[model samples]
Target: MADTTNRLAGIAYLTVDGTNYMLAGDFAYSVSKVARETLMGQDRVHGYSEKPKQGSMSGSIRDAGGLSVASFNAMTNVTVTVELANGKTIIGRNMWTVGDLEVKTTEATFEVKWEGFSVEEA
Candidate 1:
């Protein structure tokens, strides 16, 4: 078995339209498969297949700094590239849209959520 303890923190980031965002602070990403089953006959045997589907990415960033929430808020569609802690990268390829944006004045931070038609690791 692989040693889980060897894992270390890596860069978590997102790029929209070739512009880098979320270079610092805490962030997370996840991808899930969309699947369906087809019944073959009265016997109830079924064939199953799956494919990449819509995904979500969320995280919080401390200090607004140079980050622009307005740009993301006005966006209807965007291409996002996310680098995970494990050194894997996922590219949304113009299928993503910013879903939510929240700014906390007391904490001087902001959080964002993005949802898309599909997501794949590249």
Candidate 2:
């Protein structure tokens, strides 16, 4: 039978250190490699080469005291975990924050993103 739990409920959360934060917006993650063409053939494309898989995640949290811009900036060698409603989880180790956090009088929220080694499903 097919699992349709995800269609019934939308729930995803981010865990940094030991704290969990419900994602304010959509939580997006990706694992990809940098592919390039190898030696070119005479007329057509030859082979291809690929680097290691790169993993990253981007999401926003409601402006709160759990994570401040200064605290997130000082993080290093951290583990990030994402839990989905479908009983799926992905983990990223040694990930660091590489974000473009901006503050405005109109709003207090800040954007967050993490990039590091390959993500592993757990």
Candidate 3:
């Protein structure tokens, strides 16, 4: 049987540089491999080849305590830990680099973007 659990319903949070930032409304974390393909000369059919390249993990967090803003302004690499609702955690090495920070006055919130490498589930 296939597992039909709604994992998204579980709470998700991120800890960056020892500061915990909870999801404000939405968040995204994805890893994609860069691929290159080569096509062979075709008699009747052609074959394709590909290779996987280094991938990255990126996402945004709701800047609750203004710590994320400070971190970004400092231009520092931080350790990241993502804790999911189902008790699984994704940990990243000290390679996380802070990116753009969006501030919305109407919503009274700040959104911080981060990217990192060497992430793994634990």
- Native-vs-model 2 lDDT? 0.74
Q: Which stretches of candidate 3 lie over 4 Å from their true place?
A: 1-8, 31-55, 65-68, 73-75
Give lDDT: candidate 3, residue 56: 40
Query: Candidate 2: where is the Cα deviation over 4 Å?
Result: 1-9, 33-42, 104-107
lDDT of 1 by residue, 1-122 (tens): 96646566765777777887645467666667675556576787777666666676666755457767776677657777877767678776544446566778887667776677766777
Q: lDDT tens digits, residues 1-122, model 3? A: 74637554557787766777656665555444445676867564376677764334455445455444665646346666778776677776655455556766665456555555456677
**Global lDDT of each candidate:** 0.67, 0.74, 0.59
Which candidate comes out best when scored by lDDT?
2
lDDT of 3: 0.59
Give the TM-scores of the predictions, in the order they appear.
0.64, 0.76, 0.63
TM-score pick, better of 1 and 2: 2
lDDT of 1: 0.67
Off by over 4 Å in 1: 1-6, 35-53
